[model samples]
Target chain A: MDMTTPLVEMREISIAFGGIKAVDHASVDLHAGEVVGLLGHNGAGKSTLIKILSGAYRADAGEIRIAGEPVAISSPRDAKRHGIETIYQTLALADNVDAAANIFLGRELLTAWGTLDDSAMEAETRKVMGRLNPHFRRFKEPVKALSGGQRQSVAIARAIYFNARVLIMDEPTAALGPAETKQVADLILELKKQGIGIFLISHDLHDVFDLADRVSVMKNGKVVGSAHVRDVTQDEVLGMIISGKCPPGAVAGPGALRS
Target chain B: MTESVPAPATPSQDAKSFADHLRAIEFDARMIGMIAALAVIWLGFNWLSGGAFLTPRNLWNLSVQTASVAVMACGMVLVIVTRNIDLSVGSMLGFVGMVTGLVQAQLLPGLLGFEHPATWLLSILAAVALGGLIGLFQGALIAYLAIPSFIVTLGGLLVWRGGAWWVTQGQTIAPMDSRFRPLGGGIEGAIGTSASWAIGLVICALIVAGIAFARRRRKRYGFALRPLWAEIVLAALACGTVVGAVAIANSYALPAGVARRLVEAKGGTWPEGGLTIGHGLAVPVLLALAVGVAMSFLARRLRFGRYVFSIGGNPEAAQLSGVNTRKVLMLVYGLMGMLVGIAACISTARLNAATNSAGQLDELYVIAAAVIGGTSLAGGVGTIAGAMLGALVMQSLQSGMVLIGVDTPLQNIVVGIVLVLAVWLDGLYRKRLG
Candidate 1:
């Protein structure tokens, strides 16, 4: 529970699919109130590594420790139980249902009669949504009708409402316009103020620079290098991603990221 | 959790402008379309039948005829909503009917020395359970084993139908226990005009209360709602339809043939003319309504229903949201199975016999009803009420065409065309909404 202990510590995770290595000996971690940016090109195995952490896939070899406590996350439920929440690119929403229903799909707030407590859920949704996106007003439409930013608000609201301490946002701003992306950035900054750690996966160098405190570059299912954002230029991080070589005189080097 | 959240939007806040009021109100557009379609179909058929179609006798018969399909269609809505189809339901019905018929007509007679009242109840329960068990088996294969629902149900269709035939060597089982007849709206199954009115009124009351509670919740959540007049109009419309249906059903008097037989059986002289209001509400129709209401509640008011729709809408998203998609799929199928059992009992009781082909081609009709009533074949969008109306529309078309003396082949051709047209219309409606 001490601030010095990283919020999440994943070690030497490896997973293979059909005799091909998707992720091999990769490690990533986040500290309290910090954003760890994971950057890699397609097929670089960054997503594969994150999926393992999100409990969508089990690593064939690895151990995950949260706040110095080893844990096994075999499913999305297990991930959530460990206070981890994922906002996938698809937003993972049921477009036919309104916001409140989508937010509480599996974990619905129920009345004494065991029926859905729609009012309570909606009130909570309104509270979280208002904080995440100040001008959001389409309360009745499904997440599909919401703009990219508004949809992100709903997803974030769901994750935050569940008291997520470790939030994984995958390409959240990828589809968003500049304004919406900025809105999401603001929301993430506010979340950081609450001491929640975020693992942000993005291809946009600008997003990484704007939000990340540390950048971890993955190439061919391995951590190319880890560096404090202030210590390495964007080109150096790009080099680490493309050639799997760490730049000289970097604050964070391979194996040196181990706490 | 933040001060950024605004004060609740009150009704008066948006009520100042009519367009604002209008824009704020969101209702199920598809449901309105269904009501309109059903009206047009009813009127068109009445016109085609030269008034015979709208008569109390024909209308009452249509309600009863729609029962089996409507009952199955309610469950089919849930099945279809969860991105699955149960093509074996028709065959399942035949299988269940065979089970019921075998027990009540053959096994019970032999075991108890004659058909007993309790035997009928026991047979009904067994038949429904068997239907559910069949559904669970198929659902498990699709959900847990990763087989497609189409394949599993398609195989079930053949296997269950063959099983039905195998059960009795294709010989018809007849003369169900006398007690079973009432449950199927046989001669003794009518609830009478007064009871029909009573039940309809009670339903109306419940519906109004439900609407009021919903409105209150919406207001509390600061969500926009339809105007008071709009709510009145919708409630009155529903209430009127129910009352009108009951009245029409009551107007059909027992024919002279039935009246004479009843008087003879009662050891009373038949008057020169005695009018007996046609049995008001067929028991099967009532049962269908009950099933429809219960299923509707489950689909709209419970966690299970929400999970089913979310899973159908987006399985990946549902899974990530921690929904147990496979379990929902299995339970949905299991529920569909139980409804099939109820439908089987109704079909058997109505036929007063169980034949191998008892529910021949009914899967097509049930699916057709669900699709036409607004359940999307693609899944994630459906309503039990709409499916029930869809059943009514299809049955009306079939019965009206038969009354018009259309050739059986031509009748099939017309239904096929109508199904295509209805689906096409649904697609267009969705596109327009988008």
Candidate 2:
């Protein structure tokens, strides 16, 4: 239960549907204050593996440990209870509601009269966005009216607002511009400094190289390799993803990182 | 530890503020268009019919007539906003009205040997609850069983209308409890003429206060505010309508014959120097207002309402956010059911009877009203106030046609054409906005 133990230790995770393994024997560990980037091509089981830990899907085979204690995350509520939050690629926001409402969705702050304490939510949203994007100002407008980058700010704010220790962000900057992407990169670094463990899923190698301390590549429902960023090149990770074979020159490859 | 400083630059802030103002003006224009349409209908009919349409008596009658449909439209706004429909509402109304008739006129009176006001109140409650139950059942089937709401409610349309007929063997049930007459706009159910004027002024004042409060709140958050001219224009139009309608109503007194009967029945002197006016606001109108307020609160202020819009906008997103789609759906239908029950009770009470064909094809009218009020068929956009206006628009057309001696068949054709035109105009507006 101390900081020395891995914040999340997901081992040998496997999920199958109709006898087809979507994610097979996937293992990744995150420390108390580190960013681990999970990379793969489309349909490479990258999402399925993280979904098991986020409690959006179940793993037919695997064990998940938090602070060295095994835990079952049967639903999103369960995952939230364990302070594991996911920001899906779609952003998963109700477009008709304002940013404040979206950030506090499913976990609204109530007033003394028992209605939604919108002012409190708005104030907190202001604080979060002020840190993440100083130029963001559309608090009352629905998220649909906000730009893609601003919407990302809301989703990111929601994930971090509830004291999430382990964050799973899938393509957090996919729809963002270069400036917005840099803002998100900065936010990720800020989260890292706060001692949160983040499983960053992205197709952007540049982002992974810049933000992630450790990179894990997946191919065909299995991990290709896990290597520290300083020890391996982006092409080495790409080779593992495309060929399902670890680059021989990598510090941590299939044999060393396999569960 | 430092709080983020508000940007002090003016150029971008002013430009952004102006953009917000422009958007607000667009919204105000839409609302103003609705009011203008209402005026066109009112003045057109008034001019064509020699001012009869604009008379207070006719306006008062119109208000009560629009009450029931408007109340239901408030609920329908939610159902449609959730990307769902309830085609069974008309039949549900007939069925509930029939049951209510039995409870008030026969069942309770027969069982208890005498009807108390409390007993009548209980009957109304029972009828409303029955509506909720029926709605819940249909909603569960649609939400949990995964049947489409359109299909489920369409099936309910047949089942419930059939059930209504079976309840009384196709005979028209009559002689609703005397206490129920007020609910149908009877004299006893009305607010007096002076009180009506007072309420009318209060409502106008409330609208002004509400606008000011919202402006202050938005400003406090640094959001854009509408320009002063747009706000002034909208408020003036709204206040003028309210005050004008009440002034017209205050001008009308009871007809001489009705007044004589009232004088005879109450053994009271007819006031000198002025015509004795009838009661002002009807009970049904009050009921509809309550429904409107409560429904708007549910649709706008409550978490349940926010979820309804969210579910309508993106069901997958809502579900992924952990909203219980099935439960919210069920509750929405249940709320619609309760409103339908109130409508049923009003119609039966007004008519003093429930016929087998009571509320027949009323669903077409109700749905048409909701759509005309800007409840998008595509969902995720609507307002209770808009729906209320829609109901008023429909009722106005029907009443005006009847007054002008238009053929019933021709009236139907005209109304149908207007519904299509309204929707088409909505689409055009949406395109222009884009």
- Which predicted model would earn the best TM-score? 1
Categorize the docking of model 2.
acceptable
Give the DockQ (2 decimals) of all models. 0.43, 0.39
User: lDDT of each prediction vs. the true structure?
Assistant: 0.85, 0.83
Across residues B292-353, which tens digit of lDDT does each residue of candidate 1 receive?
A: 98998898779998899898788888888888889989989999999999999999999888
Superposed Cα RMSD, model 2: 3.9
Write the residue-wise lDDT of candidate 2 on A1-259 in tens digits. Answer: 1348898999999899899888888888999779999988898889998888988888898899998999998777788889999999999888877888888777777767666667677888989878777777778677887777778888888899899999999999898878778778888898899999999999999999999998888877877778888877877787777776666655443323343
Clashing pairs in 1: B252-B278
For candidate 2, what is the interface RMSD? 5.3
Docking class of 1: acceptable
Residue range B1-434, candidate 2, lDDT tens digits: 11222565656765665434556575645566787899999999999998889877788889889988988899899999999999999999999999988887788887776666666686689779999999999999999999999999999999999999999898888877878767877555676678878889898999899888777876776656788787888789789977776676566676676766767778877666545765667789879988998888877777888789888877877776667788999999999999998998788877878776888888888899899998888878888889998999999999998888899999999999999999999889867754
Fnat of candidate 1 is 0.53
**lDDT of candidate 1 over A69-163, digit per residue (tens):** 99998888899999998888777888878888888877999989998888888888888777777677767666666666667777778888888
